[model samples]
Target: MTDTTSVFENSPEAEFGDYVALLKPRVMSLVVFTALTGLLVAPVSVHPLVGFAAILFIALGGGASGALNMWWDADIDRIMRRTRNRPIPAGKVSEGEALGFGLALSGISVVMLGLAANWFAGAFLAFTIFFYVVVYTMWLKRSTPQNIVIGGAAGAFPPMIGWAVATGGISVESVLMFMLIFMWTPPHFWALALFMKSDYAEADVPMLTVTHGRKATRTHILVYTLLLAPFALALAATSIGGPVYLAASLVLNAMFIAGALRIRRRDEAAAEADGYRVEKRFFGFSLSYLFLHFVALLAEAGLAQFGWGGW
Candidate 1:
């Protein structure tokens, strides 16, 4: 359970923007994009209005997860430089307000998603919220070095939920989409951990970098990036894949592997001398790596309309 004691004095009032910030809109945007991609790439077609509502509810669920996370982590958020300004830690919103807001959004998002799409997708979204807030945030984050490895599942679920919204069930394609994010996550976050340096350590978050050492983390990034390649390329052989996706995956995977290798070979002295330029570049490229792969998937979906996409 989260320590409910106030970490900061409550602000007089939380503005509308403060409320939005509590939602972690930047993270929510990624959720919306990936979930939207899942919906678009699925074999089934949904009414635009229905699809729109489903995506909205899913985004709400993601936001709810963020709120609850902030509420729970308020104590540590106050300590972490990267997170010190979050609504809860900064005193813009009270913990009670964040909790109540999160609960409200969670309920609404789940119930409305069930109504707008299928009950399966709704239940999945509910489970996702639970996994993120309870399982990941409350359980794994502070306890284990593998937190991000497992917690990554919470972020990975959006695309699957989007696929479920359209198909009313799961499939190889959806699972592949899920795996793509799941595999991509460790390296992506480990890179951030690499650059963020002491933030996680000061917070006592037990991130892989802190627990296993930077060398191990770098090696893990390379191994995961290598493992990610097979899954990415395999997706190109699926019904959703096409020439565009295959071409994109090939180039992206090559570059991603190269980036990982660069990180793996560098020592702390070299990194410090260069101000961690290589790691920072790797982190920035990681964002494009995932985005371009998804965009390639979307491109394949679009091309299919013209009879040029898919196996």
Candidate 2:
């Protein structure tokens, strides 16, 4: 369905690093971390080796999705400044090679995850790959401005998959973790879209800024941030939450809300004058914010073994 025909180039064979680049390492890191957190926080216990294998395969599944995304979006990647240097877009990797690589990894990750962990986790990984490539990439991505809004589910699934790996099931706690990521995705991405200039435009991607303009994007960011705060706090009420998580969420949410209000009140004139520092800082803080929440959750789980997680 993607118009990738004209985007081909004749170049040297791709290097090993090129294959790795195809995996979208940055995105994979988030998947690995969140997935690890999910496995760690689950009430059930898993052997260290089994848990490691599960996370590794889940990371591979995430990487496979990224590789296929690069393959499909090669045309647009060539146009977007941020993505122009990616292996597929740069001619370092052929589209067919990337496609084959993605498919192989997809099969291996899912089948092995099923064997190494549980069928549900493995099946979830398969559905995740399908949703990302078939639903988000081929369908929602170019078709709607709400693409990331729905597509966020692809990333949110890692934590749920991790939980499934541990417990072989889903629960309110795991769903809360999924919701935490789901609610955070929009504002997190919209911030990047805000200061990213015209990369989306040149690629013909209907990013919020490309569709609704910066004003609406800013407002949406604030609204999502406001909503995300309470959802995150709600996790503190679950079995996993503790005094530490509660304290961290309270302070973090206050700071996050303040940051969102600052961005909401910002105007184009002030943004240009300041190089969009506020938005950029908000973006950076968002990354830290997410990492710390998981870290707090992990801390609670760790301490809970000593009976300190709950109030």
Candidate 3:
């Protein structure tokens, strides 16, 4: 069938699942988890119901951003294998509907967050949605290889927003949470780019792998991995970290660095011929890497509650 044919069949009303797909549920889950970590670890406290509301709004904002992103990137997404089946690209949702849904949800999330939590949290949520949709998807993705590196700021805002919901503002502690995700985005995305080089090349996108070649991408991975280590440790040094964080950081960082080093050692042909097992393994591990770090932070928060451990 033609692309137009596919697009029409994929509208939100066409299938129950298409609507959920538009929200980018996987991304929302990560946002919820990280934001919860931020709320739980913050020095201040929020009522249980209010905390739940804040996280709910944050999740809604994240979904809004994803819908907007899907609306904007529908054309290229249709062409790329990795995103070809997304609700918009597959014809389950029209661009206009996605845009309207996203705009409405964005406003609702921000206003509701303000009423349920604090204005600071609400403002931060608005900014995150704007940055992700306008800054990252519209402006950055196709403009430069540094897109994920810099645009990562959009994704990194969740935990900070969560912290603000509790603490009513930013702090060194909250900023450290932001830094961990910011540093993590590059290697995480670049690994996917390495294996999906052909998808980028087909779309004429300037991913680091496409622009600089896989060899250079591998080198870049190692460099970013090196940079990631210090930031991870620095988070441990902040008020967020404790014995649990220290131990988690040490092991996760060691495995992450070792994965990058392995990628650096493999030639492009070797890496690809093995179906990018190394890159894929690293990508898989990176997911665990982020989750473990946040869980470690949660552990630290629990420990501090008992006066047993804290930064």
Candidate 4:
């Protein structure tokens, strides 16, 4: 048998914060927000305590996925300037500890969600964890230029899981929410890749910018931004949609497309000369773009209580 001593060797003593870093808190926040939006916008109502518990469990599950991703990607993380300080990469947590923490949380979160909500929602969460850890992190991230394109589905599932928490099933509204994130992910990550310099290339991750060239990646960002518009607009016609969402969708999509157009038109010389200002600005706007769209959905949901919301 192979000697496994190094695999389980203890690293430096880890702090509470280091362990938390293993959870990728920023990504978990997005998961929580989108999931909460899905639950709130659903036609069915959940008791406050149950809704709270469901969201908590869902957030835990998302964190579990993040931990597992960190465990698996520890090597890549060490090589990338953007990720070198992560728990495992920084020697603050052992791979074994991260793997164990992730697995324990995964089990607890799935079981608690099932008890708090419905079994279907629990199963969906389980599948999401599996997809992110096994499918996206393990399989796609290193192998293909289309990793973010296909792997984006794993991130897109949170809102649907949230919708299921209330309705205990799927619907057009939940699906549109899923599509909105799914379509937006490629352009969002691609823009980051555009400005990230050689992180992906040095790490040997097959990002579009690494394998296909920046020009192709720029074209892709434009294409995805254009494709994303329809889904965002279509959600405005759903039961959960209203004037607020429609107006937000129109303006955000217009601005997003304009950003993508500017990105596509720029060559490397121009981008490098300006320090990738356009790409960086586009990336920052993409975060606000998603957040504002969801906030508009929440606003519409609130307005519906006063009979001023949906069409």
What TM-score against the true fold does each predicted structure earn? Answer: 0.96, 0.96, 0.95, 0.96
lDDT of each: 0.94, 0.93, 0.91, 0.95
Clashing pairs in 3: 7-91, 10-91, 10-92, 10-93, 11-92
Sort the predicted structures by lDDT, highest score first: 4, 1, 2, 3
When 1 and 3 are scored with lDDT, the better candidate is 1
- Model 3 is weakest, by summed lDDT over 10 consecutive residues, at 7-16
- Candidate 4, residues 289-311, lDDT tens digits: the string is 99999999999999999999999
Clashes of 3: 5
Clashes of each: 0, 0, 5, 0
Candidate 3, superposed: residue stretches over 4 Å from native: 1-12
Compose the digit string of candidate 3's lDDT tens values, residues 79-170: 99999999887777889989998999999999999999999899999999989998989998999999989899998999999999999999
**lDDT measured at residue 278 in model 4 versus the true structure, 0 to 100:** 99
- For candidate 1, the per-residue lDDT at 107 reads 99
